[model samples]
Target: MEKVRLGIIGLGAEGGMYAGFLTDGKVNNMVLGAICDIDPLKRTMAVEKYPEIPFYEDYIQMMDSGEVDAIVTCVPHYLHPQMGIEALKRGVHALVEKPAGVYTKQVRELNEFASTKPELTFGIFFNQRTNSLYQTLKKLIEDGEIGAIRRTNWMITTWWRPQGYYDQSEWRATWGGEGGGVLVNQAPHQLDLMQWICGMPAKVYSKVKYGYQRDIAVEDEVTAMFEYENGATGVFVTCTHDVLGTDRFEILGDKGKIVVDGSRKLTIKRLARPESEMSSSMSMQDVMKIFMGHSGNDIYTEEVLEFNDAFGIQHISVMENFAANIIDGTPLIAPGSDGIRGVRLANAIHLSSWLGKEIEVPFDEELFLAELNKRIVAENKYPVNA
Candidate 1:
């Protein structure tokens, strides 16, 4: 294809941001052919900025135009699956935003449909995977630098959202609207990163609290423990109500410990062992090089550069990948199936919280959906007058 024609659904914050990337020539081989949003105001706002492109209040209208080769679905959590399914059915590859869907069934359904339609490439925007530090960390773990991981802990209190933020969206905290809170929204990246680095957990136990910091009906705080199949243990704690912010991850293994603070600095203490004895008894000064190598600011810079390179000059990296996967048979950076795991983990956390017990892996999807439906009803009936 000479140029990948693009259509974007949902002209909200994320949609607008991605549109900026598109217009700025960050992604190559792509042209903004059309845009869609249910809210006419949002559509008008986006069109005001890019008046040359066609704007449609309904996504199907854009889809029917057959002018776009690929689609970017930045719609709300609940609509992701529906929009994606439709896009794939229409033979347009899709790049969807995070959490893919609000429920496990929706994710599975999307995955199943995408699997059958191998001609269409589906990707999720788990952009954290693009981070340089995370890439290095994943490389270290894969190369056995940590020497058989044992325990991992992440405390992410940094996502402190004010009450006004939640109030801004009707779907912010309601179960029927946005599903859960921190686990579903702010922490999906962390959960996805954890699984990406340490591997999927065999079991997950969690505790969640609603109304902890806001008037919302969903969780604002979540504490979860994960048991990995490799006998590794993990702890994840996140909240939106913290007075101060904290974003840190520490991984302990037989060889050494790796800690990453919010400052983006990584510290690795190589244990003195037989291998070290053969080399030398290195003090902190001797090991400083290893720490500094991993501590540099290259990762973040590299991530942005890569995204720009891939998307620049016609700005089609995301779209092109989807197109290539369908036409040229390229592998996706973050496939649709991979997106399901994070939501499943989030659901397990919610289930564990509701039952006050550790929930096992491969949770009963039906049971979770049923409980979520009940929560949705309660949330809808919540007294707005009170």
Candidate 2:
């Protein structure tokens, strides 16, 4: 194939937005040759706009039509794994959106199933991984530029969704609909990035407020604490209620620290001497003198880390890389297997809050599913439309 043909499933807001990447010339060597949506209006609009592209109401038909070698799944939170499994069974490559699925069981099953198809390319739409700013952070952490991490904190409260937004759809901001609130929907990118740069937390304890601001049943505010394998602790806080929101992520380490603010400004602080070295070298009297403020000791230097813009890399970059992986065997920016960690973390948050305890990562999947099923079985609880 000279160029990889693409099929997009679910032409909702997300699918429609990604479709423009190919049509708008943001992604190269990728052609939107097929589209699928149950909504007749979405199909009609897609067809009217691109008559050259084939349209199908059914995903199976789109996969069988051979109109595309790869399919991008941008449906709701729950249908991702189901649709991905279907596409993989047909030997079609898949690029899935965030959250992977509503729960880890489904996502794990999808991962296991996809593992059987080694030849097919499977990537997740973790577009933030393509961001130059995060790329720099990941490199810094991986290279020990900040030494061993002591604590990580990301107070990302900028995902302010209006009440009218939830009213736009019934299956949103509900357990059975969108499957959790800001944590699953608006915060998945941050959740993924959190674990991506630092590493997955070993245990998580959270306090969540449901319908705090919106007239919905799911959590709109979340404050979670994390325990790492290396004994480091972390905090994650987010809400959709604050208007003067902020996005600040910082990783504190023994040797230094990095801080990224709302303006994408990155600040670095490096220690003049290791805390261990300084403490060990100083006498108790001297340490007490400095501690008592009788003497002063400067231990660190602060400076801004500078880097050039990365040419506006974002969703299109992920898409282009997906195509390259299928065509030239290039590595994916986000592997589909890694998508489950975020879902697991989200589940742990929900579970911990529900039980009022700190839950460990890889928490019992069967238990989580059972708890989810209880909610789904409630009268008019789960959104059938979703």
Each prediction's TM-score versus the true structure: 0.86, 0.93
lDDT of 1 by residue, 256-285 (tens): 677877726676655544333524565665
Clashes of each: 10, 0
Q: Give the top-scoring candidate (lDDT).
A: 2
Number of the top TM-score candidate: 2
Off by over 4 Å in 1: 274-327, 381-386
Model 2 scores a C-alpha lDDT of 0.87
Distance (Å) between predicted and true CA of 107, model 2? 0.3
What's the distance in Å from true for residue 174, model 1?
0.7
lDDT of 2 by residue, 25-122 (tens): 77886888799999889878997887788999999999999898999888889999998999999999999999899899889999999999999999
